[model samples]
Target chain A: MNAIDHPLVTAYLDAVARETAELPAERRAELLADLREHVEASDARDDDQVREVLTGLGEPRTVAASALSEETPAGHIHPAPVAPGRAKLTVILLGCSGPLLLASSVVGTIALIAGLALLWGAPRWETRHKVIGTATAVAVPVLVFVGALLGAASRIGPIELLLLLAFSLGVPAVGATVLLRAVRR
Target chain B: MNEAGGRVPSQLRKGLLEYCVLALLRDEPKYGVELVAELSAVSVMTTSQGTIYPLLSRLRREGLVDTELRDSPSGPPRRYYTLTAVGLASLTEFARAWPLFRDAVDHFLTDPQGDPA
Candidate 1:
């Protein structure tokens, strides 16, 4: 049946579709079919009556929320919870170490190449993997630029940077593993 | 409305909602709007699409009811809800237990000293 002919049902489906865009297409079609059946059975004699009925069904978001709450599938990703202390630490670290890591890598690579070139005393030192290595070599400097911007915004210092590095990598790798294991039981 | 003594608070009647809907749909498939009107006639607990839609979804998931979509002559497509075999069994079970539960509650409230005697 054409949904456009029945505006009430169409509207309902449209709302559902908008809310469930992330859902598989087949599953979404099934939901629409179910809702269409509901409209057909109702004694809404006219379009106005049907619209009124749908209006009472609450907003699409609420409908989606209720549906989601009732039937979430296994292995769905829940948003990671960021505690106040940890969030603050993350912001500080991302800001400071991000830039430092980027800058040091770029400067270190350039220094190494310049030292080699001096030893060879050649006007040009071209390696077979120079293009790939150059690309890789620039990665840290870019990171440093982005990290410096973040750090400046967060007002993080060198000392905070070190602490952030320790926490950011250490917490997720070691602390999280231990904490998750404990919670699983 | 006044068959009993006073207005029945919705909270007290909430327990019977699923039973009522299931019973109403047992005879014929009814859509959202019609179901609301049917339920509103018996009790003050008015049914809205918001309330009924979720209940219908849950009932379908639980295998109590099934739905079908059909074209309407003048308006949007209609969804018809029919009681499944499981739904029929559930309704029968509810009918059997409802009276006993109702009576127990009635007696407790009416008994002066909380004694059924």
Candidate 2:
């Protein structure tokens, strides 16, 4: 029965989260957490008071806009950093990981881990980039491993294998390319 | 009932709001809700009171402020934001410069007839 648990309040917060999807994770989380605490502390005992509290918070999109605008100098926001990508090695590891991982080699595993470590550590790349890089990097092995198990049990077909191969190559390629362009932006 | 006229965002206040926050913390630290309440009290400076947190976050990131968990008299421990030395310095600088800036702005507002004195 807490005011914050009201549907309207939840919707407003959800909208804020959706609109601020581009912010750095910690900043976005802190904003939402603060807002949650704000709502909780408002002591809105009824629907009318809850509505008033939400009204005082303004539209979620506006709040998100204000938060994003604060991050930039010219009021123009970029989804990625403006600095050139210095994580070339990370890109290389991710980009080439598909073929490396197909062999199930220990070196491939090492390279994948290194690529992810570097991707996360690279300050120029935003968290989204790191996430994409990580997901794509990890996906290669997972897909291949599943494909290998299925291939052994003879449950997978040639078409599926071919498609897997294509994804194994294409997904990481696209992920790595997106990361390159992101940092280059 | 969401009313569109409920709040007005003062765009001109964007750059100065952080200084206002610094001023708010000048005397003592404040929890999140308390800060929001004080800020929204000003009609011109009001917007989504929640937006202040991001500004506060940036201030902390920039080493202008620091936070600590303090036990409150009621509900739960609140995170109290305290102004750092750097924050005080920046606030002092802003205080020193605001009057000159305000006078310049006021002169233009009061004398918009191309007066050059």
Candidate 3:
């Protein structure tokens, strides 16, 4: 190893790189570069000074966490670890809206809207997932409302309608699955 | 570390931390090690000095600061960060507001029970 590549410093930096795998590649590179510059500049005369420099740098995980939070957009103000509970609740609410709409439109609308609110608010999933989730979850109600207004549903049998509801449920179900899988936790 | 994965770093006024960083560059350009050292010297800021890199990176991205790579007399070339026109304006604005903001916080802290009216 080069003289500046102190064993302890290398280990710390390696850990930080591993923890920051989720950061945008450009950001991760910039961060690592900045850290490397600092380590090189410290130029500790001995192991003890090296230790003090590393201690001042703190744990790798903390450095990664702080780095991650800084990248989160201005309004996000994310709390600590992502909540699995929130992700689960969001899935259930959005995924069930189609089935519930068949039983009661008012209840179904409430669930879909609430689910959408949570979906948009949660940071676990990206904006793309949120848009897809919203689209799929709302598709059933929208189709139903539009079909009714246009008299398209008048020609369909009960079994066909049930199939339509199931189809609607299926799309949002897939959407919810994608979101659950995407949870940053 | 106290609670397995808990982050227990002291919460200094978050905005103040970045502004303090910007303030450091107002007079003259400073390198990464120099800036980090200045912050670490203050116990009240109380954080792992490494975390300040992200803030520095952000300050650069936001056009508040600009960096120049210069050859150091010692080892590797050092990246020196200098405040920009925008940065100076922002620091001045914060300096103006901070006294009032500080006094308000002090007032509440000192007179917690006396001003229930």
Reference-based lDDT, residue B38, model 1: 76
How well does candidate 3 reproduce the true complex, by DockQ? 0.54
TM-score of chain A of each: 0.35, 0.50, 0.55
Overall lDDT per candidate, in order of appearance: 0.57, 0.81, 0.82
Residue A48 of candidate 3: its Cα lDDT? 80
For candidate 3 chain B, the 10 contiguous residues with the lowest summed lDDT are B1-10
Best-matching candidate per TM-score: 2
The order by descending DockQ is 2, 3, 1
* TM-score of structure candidate 2: 0.63
The DockQ scores of all candidates, in the order shown, are: 0.26, 0.59, 0.54
Give the alpha carbon lDDT tens digit for every residue of A25-60 in model 1. 655566555556555555566777777656655566
Judging by DockQ against the true structure, name the best candidate: 2
Model 3, runs deviating above 4 Å = A1-3, A76-185, B1-9, B113-117
The weakest ten consecutive residues by lDDT in model 1 chain B span B1-10
Q: Which prediction has more favorable lDDT, 1 or 3? A: 3
Worst 10 residues of 1 chain A by lDDT: A119-128
